[model samples]
Target chain A: MKLRESVIDKSIVQNFLVDAVRKFSPYCPGDLSMATPLIRTGIVDSLTIMEVTKYIESCINTSLPVAKINRESFRTLEALSDMLFDFIKEHNLDLDIDGLKGMG
Target chain B: MDNLGQVLERSINLYPDDVALICSGEQVTYAQLGERVAQFASYFSGLGLNKGDSVAIASFKSIDVVSVMQAALRVDLVYVSLDPRFPPERLKELIRDAAVSVVVLDEFLSQEWSKLEFLPDCIQYALTLHDEKKLEIKSDVKCHNFKEINSDSNDYKRFVPQRKGEDLAYLLYTSGSTGKPKGVRITHDNALAFVEWAASEFEFSQDEHFLNHAQLSFDLSVLDLYNAFLAGARVTLLPEDDAMFFSYVVNLIRDDQITNLYMVPSGIIGLMDKGALMKEAMPKLKRILFAGEKFPVTRLKALLDWVEPNQEVYNLYGPIETNVCTFSKIKTDIVFRSECPIGEAISNAQVALRQDNGIISYDGEGEIVVSGRCVSPGYLNSPILNKSKFFLQDNHRWYCTGDYGYFDKNKVLWLKGRKDNLIKIRGYRIELDEIESHVQDTELVDDVVAVFHGSNSESGAIVLWCVFNQQALDSYGSIDIVVNLIRQKLKSVLPHFMLPKLIKSVKELPKTNRGKVDRLKLKERGI
Candidate 1:
């Protein structure tokens, strides 16, 4: 199934962060936030980043350009949501950009 | 000292006309190679070279380099094959670290080394000819024609006879989390054990022609060179240039009928991208071994679809410290999956999951530890690393692989990811902390995190997440510029195998509550 931003909102990403932190990392969901760090706090790793990239790509139904594959684009749930929205808009991509924007 | 020479002598006496080495347009037979190795040993002894000394062989991957390595073994000396592309500073450092007394360089690389600060400890330098019409050896260093040194009498005494199992064979230095590279010491017994297992597993034979494309410093070469020799198989060394090497492999497969080929994921990807390897050209390839990195199961399926279904495709996984201890031989009927199974340990090896307390036999998801004859002696001169990594249990020296993996109830080993701050590129181990160190060394860089955005090894790309002091982008010119400087500096010290393919600078590096760089946060931020 194609991945859509509406289907995989900041909550889905946040949930992934929660599960990742609990499973692979030492950090527990003391207080999850949009700006909470996932990797530095030992909640995620570089290998996890590959899985996240794949998850985001499948949800959006388009390739994520290398330029957008960095920390700022992945800073937080809000940051990732906005970046996906912008990515969908820039390529005239196949997604609901306005809906994604409002959700962000 | 005479053990290697005696083996070659015996092989030559039995199979004089058997093919020894296959280069682009040259193929040397066993008898001729035996004479050449013996002649060089005589020349070295004539110059008063003794056992336990180090010799530096600087050249690209070619038949000459293989001959030099065998000759070094004949004399019971550890040979460090310095990558020709290494800057003089790195080369000199390795030469000094290994305490090399002699050097044999290709004519082209010799010109580059001539410009370096020649150490007082080195006694002689010989220049090996690449093309015909050899150039004169350098005047500053006691020079010998490496190729023509074989003209000496074949009646020669072997220099060292006590080539024990504990004798040091080679030194392969890898990037450490700390700045300096750490040498992994491989002994003769450990190397021979791995080679013996590999030779039997591949069913290598005197009739099979094996391709040796990996660099000498890589552990894969141990399987390629020594394993092939153990089976009396002809080894065709692939050149270093990408295009030339790929084209050459195609021709070698078609012309030489190479029966066995082992390569990194990227190497196979390049061939598949060019569509250069046709079924007709690779008909004799009984086995295609991929190791050092994972090949996507989809790509492996495509390759299998391209060739005969019965042609074995094996995915091998082993930390270099353990000499490729576990391997998964893909079945033709098995459908492809995204996650490749690393398979079970080799016959002589045992793999177990160790807890934080170092006890073995955790059920799921723990640090992978290997114990066998295949395991390395330890990191050279790093007692601290030895204390942390090498442990004794049940009268066996166990190597902490630092990789996270678990075994299914069926005993199939599945690798998860590394527990350390490192990544494997083309089978060469690189510490991610090493890259962060370079990034942090840049001007106005407060903190940084290097993340592996590329999922598979074939892609060979990484994106760096950076946080700067007041948008230092203008000073560094661009993110690529800062990356280029790091590459330039690293290239001088580390080989190309360690360089990152891409870089991305961000306003801030995402950090966890602990204040360390948060890699998952960087992923979420899309940095």
Candidate 2:
């Protein structure tokens, strides 16, 4: 069931983020484009950020590096997706995008 | 010693070598802090800023930020803090509303307000700090690097200005039901009266260390910062980035040897539940203070059980206008009701139930009013509001808190919720009427009703029900898009916490017999 790092693209990670953000942050705009600012627009607050990060930890089955949580990594959907993609690549996960998405 | 500046001077003379501030693991001594305060005081004095002029800064806790606040006090300028997380337009509006002459802005928050677009004519100076970037302010306002003010120092004449007790110390803005935020003005006498009482009552001293959990704009920070300074105690400034991270906050408390913790119940609730309170043990923390909202009983009991026998817990109560008029130190063995009493009034304050213009005694439940040294001067530029919110009775001014509460036979006060549409979420006050009014200003909707969803404020989110004017769904194609557009419109006017969680488009909002929107009905009939 292991998937190579190359199999996961930036778009897939972005889509995952969009879905995660929508689930936790109800006020988020429906049309979340790649350049949409997450924290600046008040769409994703500290509480929502916590939910999103916890979701990522659960999906990865490991603790996300607590120190890696910074403002730049969450500037926009594109940036957040890149961070997730990099996390997957760095970890060399045994699952692909769908596996990351889980059964929900 | 006429003011808080004298208090700082006294502390410096008493313990020059003692650490006064701890931020990012760097320690600042009392003498060093005294020099920073004097440097800024001399600079501000050199400028033509009136003694009572306002200084606006971002509400981030840091060594320099605290120093600037002290310097303002030293020169008798009123201090104010604007949360940088708020939208640029809103921040600009606050600056204009308060008539701020000087602003200390963080360079990293450029995205939020780098280009305030148009500077209000009242602004005379802006200090760009927190980073190396010389962030450009595209305005006629004189901009300077905050760091350079220290380096470009001239002969610093150290002197504390003489100020009457009634001179304004700071202005804290809270959500107003009248569709705009109102500034609560605190004078030195108003603040010092409370600080002196609380520091002595709570026993804050040189050995104790308090954590700056509340935002600088919040009144809670007054309790932490002022008390520490008055007692020659140390304060650990929590960085904005690590604020919500419970693990990090708990770790900081343990690592920094923080002895005192004061925060809203919501923050403490999160820290207790998610932060793993027992791990990286904080034995140095001796006193825990909670305020702003009610703490759930079960979680509170668990927290009380977890702490050591020496650690004391207290529930402090007050609105922004009255800084902690009442507090209850919880006794672990006392059996509980569904709610705990808010305790008796602090020294220099009198608490009672009031009806009409008269004060009522222990039995009757009416609007909670406090008359004493802790009362704010009044709202800024709000004569009509000042007339209604504050009143002279029995030759003493009393601030009407608008909260309905009664005292039991034990002389303990219990809260009975607010009489207005104001609500608190994570200690940030939101006026539901303000949201509805702003949404109506857009004119895209025929009517908008804002209601809280969920059982209580601790777990609830704001929901807006709107009836579009015409062709709204057709133009937007979907309800989601319509809601998004409305939210996008609202971001510029309101703070992030005040934004509605969900927006629903309905043909007509339900109304009561009086022809007013039935908010209770809307809250009951959830989407």
Candidate 3:
């Protein structure tokens, strides 16, 4: 049996995450790097995280599993996007890149 | 007898060993808490602070903070709760307004004290709550550590000053519509009436572990702290950092077996959105009380379905001027018309609706006016506001609540909107809340805010800002699609004049410090 290789576009995921953060947290200053801590830097607290997660789930067309809905998965833009990509690959869900680009 | 200090003293005598406070992984029994208050009271007496004096507390919620508050009341001093989150300038403004002589602050905020402009002249003594560092004191101010104060011997006879029900107990500053914070003067009687009613209505007992999630500065915390202490129940103060993370708060609730919770609607909504309540069956949660803002019926229903069927839920309503004058037990079989009705007045309060013609009505919509012991003594040092908001009618003092509501035939109060929220467009008056209610009722939206833009004339237009739910967003891929759906939905339900001219989709609605929608900020962002 041969294992299938996974092909993920990092830029697409980064763009989506950045746009979502900006939309949810309009008061967040300057640019948010992929490694920037969302909670530590006060970009999103418990209240605003709800909006960010909801937007991500809507874009991905999948609800995050109960276990994945936690601080670890949402610590940073990179962490969240990586989790989303992993979930997509595990579930073998189709990603409509064009649709997401237009939405962002 | 109506003094808050007497209530604490009675609880200490009745339940000495019972846990009174739980914070920072430590428990303080009623006996220990009482002792701490006594030591602090004795120390204040040594400093010549007596009845009617003001003590400002600028710190996070903790056992020490509550002890100091109780001690101030014990010594007949008015305790002022200030938010540590505020800047030094704002704190100075409040301290000057209250004429605070002594300030108790957390050690973490000691550095910010240097930035204060009025502290040099206004503050006579500074007591640090946490750290024991021999620190620099500016303005020749006397500073004391918390440990030393608590360990100080009460060898000298301490005089507990006599106080009346009308004596000021606390001063809480609330943001006003006029761009300044107004201090609401609450007397011993004003708080006692509400606390007494809550203890009876909620059936508070020592077995209940209540969660204190509100900031110490917010009036909602007043109910949580006093009601728990008065009933000899354990109050678990959720740390400031823990409150910012939903999972942490959920874990704390589960670990502590928190039986009672009092929060604003936004706090409850945030927990619900994180699927906190849905994750497990909180059998220990006996009751959940939400106040300070409107509870959307959809979210309330979701919460009811998530929690245990037998658990009680209450929707309370009151401004800071009159702390929680009305409450409604959200019955399982209850139906909502637009939003949840704020319900009837509490036992100690009387609710009346007055029309524009100065006539009180029972069944029609009018301004909500509350009377009785729950009403505060009026705004502190704000005579213009006092003259307008507080009134004497039939030998009774009534507070104009600024909220418009009507009493249904069932004697229940249904809130319409704020009186100032009324907007005139093209010579027609429209309630902004009514439009927002219709928008929230639409299946596509989770929350909605309707704001009037431009001058209140023929040129003024109504703008509707909405946040679509996950389902709606997933179904409709773009903002244009969501806007079109909402516009169509509103067109069918609203009249031509009530229809919103602009439909905007926001990721989230801006919220005020009290967690209500910041309508002022929305208005500033014109159409």
Ranking by lDDT: 2, 3, 1
Q: What tens digits encode model 1's per-residue C-alpha lDDT throughout A8-104?
A: 5545544543443333221223466666654332233333444556555644567677556555655555676577666665665554222232322
Candidate maximizing TM-score:
2
The better-scoring model by TM-score among 1 and 3 is 1
> Could you tell me which 10 consecutive residues in candidate 2 chain A have the lowest summed lDDT?
A94-103
Per-residue lDDT over B10-81 for candidate 3, one digit per residue giving the tens place of the 0 to 100 score: 778899899999898888888888887888887787788657889999887788898889888888899999
Candidate achieving the largest DockQ: 2
**Best-fitting candidate, measured by lDDT?**
2
- Give me the displacement of residue B55 in model 1, in angstroms: 1.5
Task: Choose 1 or 2, whichever is better by TM-score.
Answer: 2
Give the C-alpha lDDT of model 2: 0.79
Residue B122 displacement (Å), model 3: 1.7
Q: Model 3: how far is B132 from its true place, Å?
A: 3.3
Candidate 2 residue lDDT tens string, B1-527: 34755666777888888889888777798888888777777778777888899999874667888888888888889988878777677777788889999888775564345645787889898777676766577788887776666544422245657775889888998888888899999888888888888877888878889999888888888878888887889888886656767767877788778899999888887777666676346878888999987887887888888777788899999999998999898988856677777889999798878876475555668899889988988999899999988888777788889898987778788888888888888888888999999888877799998888875555689999999877777877787777667888887688878888778878898999999888888888886
Q: What's the residue-level lDDT of B116 in candidate 1?
A: 58
